[model samples]
Target: MALVIGVVSQKGGVGKSTLARLIACNYAASEWRVKIADMDLAQGTCTSWNRRRLQNEIEPKVAVEQFLNVDDAIKTGEQYDLVVFDGAPHSTRKTLDIADACDLLILPTGVSLDDLEPTIKLAHELKKHGIYPPKISIALTRAGNSDVELAEGMEYVRSSGYHLLDGVIHEKTAIRRASDEGKCATETSFKSINEKVDQLVQAIVNRADELGKK
Candidate 1:
């Protein structure tokens, strides 16, 4: 059985697509058959990205396809070890439907109240709709300064009664630049940022492996 991971958020530019691609590329590199379902049919961000990734002939090749329906997307999971879903930034029924189907849901957001505010609301909505608390987590991406600040952000997320991912994607131009060229954050220029990406990937993949056995 495949582990279906959904990278979702109600706010735009929160690095949801980037997170999805990171997961696919990491698993594919590790030789764990991977495929990405670009559920944001309107934007097709992951679809276009996969096209560039192929054109550039990037190593550890992974595949991606776009689908409008969650059921159709879910069907693709049977073919790979992992299926990463990059969903739209909307509070529509489709978003919740995607959340309902995933084995794990990753909500990427920045550190401040502006980013955390809407995310908090969405967290409540997911819980209200019966999304298992352990299956959902808030990943702090594009975070601000220092380990201290990141620790504070973690505390804030915990205080809000939501689980926080262990890895933080700091604000780094190297990450975005690599994405433009069809490269994963792990392949970016900064070793520090790359390490962060790797750590998060490890945590998420471990969870998938743990759940897949059940």
Candidate 2:
């Protein structure tokens, strides 16, 4: 069976799809057959992005498909090594289903209270629904260059009693441009930005591996 990872958020513009694409691309680059199940039917963000990626003929091709339900995605994903669920921006009954199905669930948020509060709340909700705390992680995304603010955000996530991924996805014009061109954060032209994204990806991989052993 393919290892399933879910990227979900309480609201939009929190980098949920970005993280999904990042994981899918990285795993595909490593020669793993990966598929991104774009569950956000309204936006279809990853679906359109994959179109651009194919048009650009990017290497390490990643498959992306829109699925109305998680079970179908999991069934299709059995042929691949990994399946990444890019869930809807807001929580619904389906959110718990995704949490139940994933080996690792990532919640991406900004540094502000606006983002942090909802992200943490969603984690608590999942826990209430019987999701294991260790399988749920918080990733800081679309963050600015303020070290103090970043530190506070990290502390906030830790204080909430969830695992906080080690690196941040710093907001950069290059990353946005790369996304516009159907590239992920790590595929930007700037090597420094790529390194930062890679750090977070590594942390994600390590966390998933650690949990798989238990």
Per-candidate TM-scores read 0.93, 0.98
Best by lDDT: 2
TM-score computed on alpha carbons, candidate 1: 0.93
- Model 1, residue 164: C-alpha shift (Å): 1.0
**True lDDT of residue 13, candidate 1:** 90
Structure candidate 1, residue pairs in collision? none
Name the regions of candidate 1 deviating beyond 4 angstroms: 146-148, 210-214
Cα deviation at 112, candidate 2, in Å, is: 0.3
Candidate 2, superposed: residue stretches over 4 Å from native = none
lDDT of 1 by residue, 65-111 (tens): 88888888778778888888898987468778888988988899988
Q: CA lDDT, every prediction?
A: 0.84, 0.92
RMSD to truth, every model: 1.6, 1.1
